[model samples]
Each structure stands twice: as structure tokens, then as C-alpha cells.
Target: MKFCLKHGRCNCVEFYQGDLAAQADAPYILEADYKTWLDVIAGKLQPIPAMVLGKIKVKKGSFSVLAQYVTASLAMIKAAQKVGIQ
Candidate 1:
């Protein structure tokens, strides 16, 4: 899945879910283990806090760039929770 989040605006964000091979490219990609991702989508963990605990890693892009989208990032998490992953 690919989620495009704009600054402080969750409503305008774009999300896509499908085969990995068909997914669109994103400049920044947040990487975590399957369990960690599930925990996040289930609202059992928070991304930033997880990163602080070394549970999540930014496999692409810089921290500074990702930091600029914190609000949108959280918004993405909230949206993911609603997807009924659990």
C-alpha cells in the first residue's frame, strides 16, 4: 500500500492498497517487521515512539524530511487503524 500524506491534512491524503509489485513509488518509505506493522495498524503501537524504541526504521528518505510530515504521518496511522487490519 502507498499512502501520500500532505502537511497537517489527512483528508487530502492518498492511499492505495494492493500487490507490492504494483504499488506506486514513494520517496520515503517506513520499514518495520510484519508484527510491528500489524501492531501499528491495530493501534497497539505508535510510530514515533516505536522508532524511538528501535521498533521501526526509515528504510528510505531522511529523518529531517519525515519529521516535516509528522502530523500527516500520524494521520496516516489513524487511517490505517480504520482499515480493520486487526
Candidate 2:
């Protein structure tokens, strides 16, 4: 059941948490919306620990490649925050 903050409307939804089968009777939600919600819940807990922090030897190149990972991570964080997650 989904609770509508506007009014005391408690939607008796058949969905359980994030189950698709339960959401079958619910309205169609966008994929982006789902992803953000998941990320927020995940963020509330501890981050993933690195199994191994071995720095692999890389070929001689500029350090710009590291920038790509940083940018993508920031974008993901922003998108997650856009949703009601934290």
C-alpha cells in the first residue's frame, strides 16, 4: 500500500516493496524513477568494500582517464538525489 502525503489516501497496492509482479496492477512508473529509489535505499547503508585494492599497472597515458570515472559517479549521485532518496 502506498501512502499519499497530500491526503490520508492509503493506496492498497498489491506490490510488495519493489516486486514487479505486485506492481502489475499499479500505474506504470518510469525506469529512471526505479533506479533512483534503489540507489537511495542502498546509500542509507554502508558502501561496498573493496575486495582487493591492487593498483594495476597501466600503460603510459595522461591522467584524464580517471576524470571520466569521477564525472560518471557524480552524475549518478545527482540523479539519485533527484529522486526522494536522501
Provide TM-scores for the models: 0.65, 0.23
lDDT of 1 by residue, 1-86 (tens): 44544554443444443345235477766667789988887778877888778798766568776777667667777877777664
Backbone-clash count (model 2): 0
* Poorest 10 consecutive residues by lDDT, candidate 1: 13-22
Query: What stretches of model 2 exceed 4 Å from their correct place?
Result: 1-68
The regions of model 1 sitting more than 4 angstroms off are 5-24
Q: What lDDT does candidate 1 reach at residue 57?
A: 75
What lDDT score belongs to each candidate, Candidate 1 first? 0.67, 0.35
- Candidate 2 has an lDDT of 0.35
RMSD of 2: 14.5
